[model samples]
Target: MIINKILNVDDYYYDVFMAISESLTGFSVNELQSTGLAETYYQHILNQIEMATFIDFLNVSKNVLDNAENKDQLKNAISSQIMDNPATQQIAQSVITLWYLGTWEGAYVNDRSYKEGLVWNVMHAHPPGAKQPGFKSWETKPVNSNS
Candidate 1:
C-alpha cells in the first residue's frame, strides 16, 4: 500500500524519507526491532519536525525538483502542514537526498552532525582528545515546589 502511494506521489516526500533512513542507517525493519531503537528514534523525529530550519529546507527541496506540475496541488496542501524542526531536519536531509540522488547517502553538502545539536550541547560533550572532561557528571535534579 505504501509503495503504491509512493509510486503515485510524483512529489515523493515519504519515499525520500524511507530511502534516506535506509541509506544512512543501513538497517532493515527487523534489525530496528531487534535493537529496540524504533521508539527512541520515533521520538527524535517528532522533535526535529518541530524546527523552523528543517521545515524550510524540506519545502525548498521538494519544490526545487518538481517540474511535472503533478505535485503542485499536494505540495500546496502539505505546505501549511509543514513543520520546521531541528529534530526532523536530519531526516529531511535524507528525504531531499533521495529526491535528488537516486540513492540516499547521509545528508547533502550540509553535513549535519549529531555532535552539534541539543543532545551534545545540553549534555556538554567534550571535544575529541580533550585534555579534561567537557561536563561534570551529575545526579538527577531535585524537584522544586515553585509550581
Candidate 2:
C-alpha cells in the first residue's frame, strides 16, 4: 500500500513506524501494511496532530527508530523516544494496543467493519456478522475433510 505523505510527515515516518511496530509486536511490516493496520491506528493519531510540536516529536521519534543498530536497539530507541513526554507515551501505548488488539479503545466503535482487522486472520474465523456457517454445520465435519 502506498502511504502518501501527510503535510510535513513523509513516507519516512511510515517506514519508521513500521519498523518500530514490527520490533514491538513481532509482526512483519508487510503483514501490518497488508491489513491496513497503520491506516486504522497510526492514521488516527496523525489525524489528531495539528501542531508543530507533535510533528517535531514524530520526526524525532522516527529518527531514533531509523538509526537503531538492531531490533533490540530499535525497540529501546522508540521506547526512549516515547518516554520523553506524556503525550508521546500515550501515542506509543495506543499504537501498541492497536497492533495487538486490532482496535483503538479510545473510540466508541472500533469494529473491523471493513474486514481488515488482525483478529479475523488470527482466529481463523470470519467477523461476527460475516460468513457465518449454516445451522448445525459446526457439529459435523466438512465433507472434504472426511478422509
Candidate 3:
C-alpha cells in the first residue's frame, strides 16, 4: 500500500482495475490478487513504459475513474480512452487477456512464459507437449482409424 501511496495511486487506481477486470472477466478481485495476476500485470505495464511514466499513467487513470458518476460512466470513460490511445490500450487489454487466458502476449516480459501462464490453472489441464495430461488420458476416448 505504501508503494501505491508513494505513486499517488493509493485509492482508486487498483480499485478501478479490479472493477473493470471483474466486470469484464467475471473473476473476483481476491482470485486475481491471490493468483498474483495484479502483480504480473503491473510488472508487464512497467516493462512497456518507464516507472515514472507508468506511475503517472496510473494516477491519471485513477483520476478519470474517480470523476465518473456511475458504473456505466466509468466503463465508458475507460473504454473510450483505451480505444483512443493505442499504446495504453494495448497495456490495458494485455492485463484483461492475461487474467482470462493466462498468457502474456507482450514482446518483452520474458519472466512470464507459457509454462508460468494461468491457463494451466484455469483449464486444469497440462501444458501441451510440455507434460502429459496423465496416465492414458490421451487415449481416454476411442481412437480414429482413418489415418
Displacement of the residue 37 alpha carbon in candidate 3, Å = 3.6
Q: Which segments of candidate 3 are over 4 A away from where they belong?
A: 1-26, 106-147
Query: What's model 3's overall lDDT?
Result: 0.58
Ten consecutive residues with minimal summed lDDT in candidate 3? 1-10
Displacement of residue 136 (Cα, Å) in model 3 is 14
Top TM-score: which candidate number?
A: 2
Residue 94 of candidate 3: its Cα lDDT?
Answer: 72
Residue pairs with colliding backbones in model 1 are 48-87, 48-88, 49-88, 50-85, 51-84, 51-85, 51-86, 52-84, 55-84
> Which regions of candidate 2 deviate over 4 angstroms?
1-10, 40-42, 51-54, 83-87, 108-115, 119-127, 130-147
Summed over model 2, clashes come to 0
Each model's lDDT comes to 0.38, 0.61, 0.58
Query: What value does the lDDT take at residue 20 in candidate 1?
Result: 31
Give the true-structure RMSD of model 2.
Answer: 6.2
Ranking by lDDT: 2, 3, 1
- TM-score of every prediction relative to native: 0.26, 0.59, 0.53
TM-score of 1: 0.26
